[model samples]
Structures are given as C-alpha cells and as structure tokens.
Target: MKILALESSAVSASVALTEDEKLVAQSFQNCGLTHSRTLLPMAENLLANCGVSLADVDAIAVAHGPGSFTGVRIGVATVKGLALGADKPCLGVSTLEAMAWGARALGGDLCCVMDARAGQVYNALFTVEDGRVRRLCDDRAIKLTELAEEIGEAPYFLVGDGADLCYNTIKENCTGLRLAPAELRFATGFGVAAAALPLFREGKACSPQELDAFYLRRPQAERERMARLAQTK
Candidate 1:
C-alpha cells in the first residue's frame, strides 16, 4: 500500500510517502511557522523525489487537528483537494494518536499533550497494549498539573510538544511516570502508514467534504464573536 501523509498540525510541517510498510520519501521543517509556503512544496517535492504521482498513491493521510487551527486547516484542506482532484480516498488521523504512536514504548499508559497556549494544553491518555493504541481518555485542554492528577495511579510515558514544557510539573505531580526524550519526539512516517493501512484495506476513506479539522476548542474568531455578542446582551 502506498499512502501520502501530510502533518502540519504543529509548527513543524512534514510530508511523507509510505510504501510497502516503508518510508520512501519524507520531508520535515521546523524552521518556522511557514506551513503555507512549505507544505505543498514539501509534498510535491517528496513525490518528485520518489518518482510517485498523486495518481499512483492509494490514499492521502493527514494529521487532523487539536493544534494550530490554521495549520490544521492547511493540512486537511490540502489532502482534501488532492483526494478530490484524483478521486482518491482520504484519511484523517488524530494528532494526539500520532503523538502516542511516537511513544509506543510506554509499556503502560501513554499521555500525549500538545501546547494549546493560554496556560493550557491539549491532552489525552492512551494505552499501548499488544501493539494496539487505545485511547483511555478523550482529548481536552487542561492545566499540566491537573492532567497529572487526573491520571493518578498509572505509570505513564508523556509525549508531545507540551511534554517538555510540563515535564517537571507532571513528574512532581505523579510518581512512576516517564517523559519521552526529544530525540524520540516525532510520530514517524511508517507509524502513520501502519495506522492507516487497516483503513485502506477496509475502504474506510472519505470525500473532500468529509475531510475536516478536529479543533477541540472553538476558533479564536468564533470565541471573539461570542464574547462580543455576550457583552452586547
């Protein structure tokens, strides 16, 4: 199976082609928040590097949400357009799940957290058992320590952008917990391909309209509008 995956939910923008359970081409950028300029180029460039075209790809996979609202839209919209243009199947994978997949060695509970700004983080708990990633909690925005308290007894491994930021706090709050190292940070291209492979086999894909970003919180503009309407009332 050949899957083209795009990940731009964070500051880093990455594109990859996974074929036959191997990564053929992958490009990642952490230079700045220049996803708008870099994402498509990286995608196009990755395809070029591998001598693969959109027509040759079996599916387009993307990290869907809970990060930069604009970044999420860019990735989702890009794949949606590609899928529609080529009449291909589309898969929207969760950013949190991807993060947890990066930390599959947790051996117990897995906690994935992404910086949500405003002194909060988008967080969730997962259990990596027998090679299956299972969500133990739904995604949410909460203070770092609160997350620690919430997952009380389980020995967990923390992964994500917010993990570094909350490392000490989480460690101080919970015993028997491990934080993933920076070197083990990325959700690999092969990992994503593995996650999407079953979906590909099951024909669980979507159209452009079905492709959507998963923003756990409302967009800033929507929140601003709601605040303004409330003030008027």
Candidate 2:
C-alpha cells in the first residue's frame, strides 16, 4: 500500500511516503517551531521526490497526539484536507505509539514521556517483547515526581524529546533506569508512518470528524482561567 504520513505533533515537522512497508521518501524540518509554516511545503517536496501525488496514495496516516496542541491540530487538519480531497482513508496513530516504533530496537520496557508543561509530562509505559509493543500503563498526565513514584522497579528505556528535557529529574526519580541511546531519542516520520499503515489496509480508520488529539490535561489557557476564578472567590 502507498501511504502518506505526517508528523507535526512536536517542534519537528516531517512528511513521509511509503510503499508496501518500505520507505520511499521523507522530508523533515526541525529548525524551530515552524511546523505550521513548513509542513505542507515539506509534504509537497517529499511527494515530488517520490514522484507521487496525493491522489495516488491509498491512505493518509497522522500522529494523533498527546503533543503540542497547535502542532497536533496542524498535522491532523492538513491530513484531513488531503484525505477529503484525494478521497482516501485516514489513520490516526497515537503519538506515543510512534515513539515506541522509534525505540523498537531498545528491547525492554519503553517509557514515552512527552512534555505536557506546567511541571508535568504525558507518560505511558510499554513493553516490547518479541517485536511488538504491549502497553503496561495507559497514557496520561502526571507530575515528574508522581511518575518517579509510580514507575515500577524494572529496567526502562525512555524516549521522546520530553525525556531529554527532564533528564536530571528522571535520573533523580526513575531509579535504576536504563536510558535509550541518543539515536532513538525522538520519533521519525518514516518510523511512525510505517508503523501505522497496517490499520489503514485493514479498514481500521476513523471518520475525519471523529479524529482527535489525546491531550492528557486541560489546555493551559483553561487552567489559567480557572486559577483567576478561584482567586476572585
């Protein structure tokens, strides 16, 4: 199956084209917070290099997130537009799931923690045994302290940009943890998109309207508003 995949759930913006589980081409830009500006253009370039157009793709896959709200929306909205125009099915892969794929070579309990900000992270636990991911903990927001307390006594390899951000805290908290190598620190468009394409072939897709980001916490703006209301009282 020919699939077009998008990754804009973080600071990086990337696009990938895959054919029959093999990578054909990818375009990635991680210069700064420019996913909104560069995503479509990157997609265009990747497609052009692969000599394929949106209509030629059998399905569109996206990282439906527990990520940057703006980043996730940009990716999902872009894919929704392309899918609608091309008349193709769409797949929503979890952002954390993609992280697992990037670290499939790590060979142990995989902990994915993306920065949810305000002293918290969106974390999930998975064990990769026999070449497949088995979820040990559901994805949700937790304070770094809470994560450390809850993270069990097992050798874990952490992935995601957020992991890097909280390195000191992790070392202090998640005791006896084994960190994954730098190469597997973050998700790649090729890795994530390829990992999610099977569902597209199996007719496991959601309506565009039903596609949603897995935000583990309320938006920061909402929290600020609630704080102000509490102060007023």
Model 1 TM-score is: 0.91
Clashing pairs in 1: none
Off by over 4 Å in 1: 187-191
For each candidate in turn, give its C-alpha RMSD to the true structure in angstroms.
1.9, 1.8
Which lDDT values do the candidates have, in the order given? 0.80, 0.79
Give Cα distance to truth, residue 177, candidate 1, Å: 2.8
- Would you estimate the TM-scores of all the predictions? 0.91, 0.91
Q: What's the residue-level lDDT of 158 in candidate 2?
A: 81
* lDDT of candidate 2 over 57-144, digit per residue (tens): 8888888788888889898999888888778878888788878876887888888878888788888888887876777877788888
Highest TM-score against the true fold, candidate: 2
